[model samples]
Target: MKEYKLSGWPELPASYQRTAYQRMLHQMSQGFVPLGQLLRVSGLGRDAVRRFLAYLQASGVLVEREHAQTPRTLLVMDWIRRTLGGTGPRRQA
Candidate 1:
């Protein structure tokens, strides 16, 4: 999945005044946001997000990048979790 970070904040136009759009901008401003999570947050199709990101890119506000090490760490943690049966301390029984 793609990721985005808001390097610069730009006000959205009148036509783009939807809650989903607002939510996206809020999330983007927080830090690096993954496309999958954004999709869930917006509840819209990928095409719509693509267009939004494109607009941000054109406006010189969006940076398309990934947190390389974080995902790797998450993968290892998930594997360990699954291998250990579940989260936290396991039952003896």
Candidate 2:
């Protein structure tokens, strides 16, 4: 199975309202997601999930992964650093 990651946050048309599919896409935007997980989370069947993913791919909202780090991973790393008091780099006043 080809892995997919969000190229960026998807921008919906003004007419679009929050839906299960949109929620699925939002979860996906946080990280790379698998088809089965997406289907389960969206509460949609296989066919519907496939169709939506295809549409997102065609519209450039989703892109094929190429050794990309997921946003979730980055968030966790940041949390770890804070917990450890790493505090990144210090700024001179």
Highest lDDT scorer:
1
Off by over 4 Å in 2: 13-18, 66-93
lDDT of 2 by residue, 1-78 (tens): 555668876666543344777778777878877776787787878987787777787778897654445699788778
Over 4 Å off, model 1? 71-93
Alpha-carbon local distance difference test for all models: 0.84, 0.73
**TM-score top scorer:** 1
Deviation of model 2 at 10, angstroms = 2.9
lDDT by residue (47-81, candidate 1, tens digit) is 99889988999999998885566788887777788
Q: Candidate 2 lDDT (Cα, whole model)?
A: 0.73
